[model samples]
Target chain A: GQQVMQIPQYQHVQEGEDFTTYCNSSTTLSNIQWYKQRPGGHPVFLIQLVKSGEVKKQKRLTFQFGEAKKNSSLHITATQTTDVGTYFCAGPLKSGYALNFGKGTSLLVTP
Target chain B: EAEVAQSPRYKITEKSQAVAFWCDPISGHATLYWYRQILGQGPELLVQFQDESVVDDSQLPKDRFSAERLKGVDSTLKIQPAELGDSAMYLCASSFGEDSVYGYTFGSGTRLTVV
Candidate 1:
């Protein structure tokens, strides 16, 4: 079975600080997607990386996919309170269409 | 923006009791998935449906868990004899495609607690 693992289970940062979370997959992935889940809320789609050595940016956030297609990272610049949540990275299952999600990195930004 | 609809934002049941959750995905979306999230963890896929047919259920506990999307529009998940360990957030998500090529749209989810 494929497994997606995330580093830094929890992070607490002051407002205006930067934050980053890393994700690694046990097997090569066709693609990887990132999601953000607010406290007590459902996961929301953030971005998807399909190409090897890809990098995409959205506002203050940046996402990178490794050349091997087995690792990814999300970095947020100048974090704000609204950025507080758990970030998860998911990859497609080897045997099916379902996704295998990493444990997630919980972010807490304080004012 | 269309949304996935889920019923009963929360639920609490006595151990050994039965509980059910419902979900309605966005219109015309052909892929639906049910996932369970334990506290402080990522969502784990319970089942997946393509149209009205099930594509995966390997992680679902068949002994006490069941799910169906009979008409390929809305779906239901049932847990019989729920146990304390069954406490978790049950999420339903839908995507326009069968794979992660298109990201998922998730419902608010049903938080369940078994006492």
Candidate 2:
């Protein structure tokens, strides 16, 4: 079974600082999706990366896909308290259509 | 924006009792999925449905867990003789297609606590 792995299980940063989380997969992925879940809330779609070596941005956040499509990263600039949440990276399973999610990186921003 | 809908935002049941959760995906979505998430952990796939037919349930504990989407519009998940370990958040999601490249819309989820 394919597995998605994420680094920095937890992160605490000061407001205005930067934060980054990395994700890796045991097998090549056709695409990678990122999600954010606030405390006591459901996961919400953030973005998706499909092309190798792809890089996409949304405001202060950046997403990158490895050339091999087995790794991805999300970086946030000037983190704010509103950025507090768990960030998850998911990939489609090799056997089926369901997505396999990483343990996720929980971000905490302090003033 | 369309959203997936789930019922009984929270549930508390005694060990060995039965519990059930319900979900209704966004209209016209063809793919639905059920996932379980323990506190401080990522969501794990429990089962997936393409229309009313189950596409996968390999990760589900069939001995105690059962799910159905009889009419292909709404779905239900049941746990019989729930154990303390069964306590977790059950999430339901829907997508416009079978491939997740289309992204997913998740419901609020049901938080189950087995005492």
**Candidate 1 C-alpha lDDT tens digits along B21-47:** 999999989999999999999999999
Task: Report clashes for each candidate as comma-separated counts.
Answer: 0, 0
Question: lDDT at B10 for candidate 1?
Answer: 96
Count residue pairs with overlapping backbones in model 2: 0
Score residue B96 of candidate 1 by CA lDDT: 86
> Model 2: per-residue lDDT, tens digit, B1-115?
7889999999999999999999999999988999999999999999999999999899999999999999999999999989999999999999986555668999999999999
Task: List each model's interface RMSD.
Answer: 1.6, 1.7
Q: Per-prediction fnat values?
A: 0.71, 0.67
Give the poorly placed runs of model 1, Cα more than 4 Å off.
none
Candidate 2 docks at the CAPRI level of medium
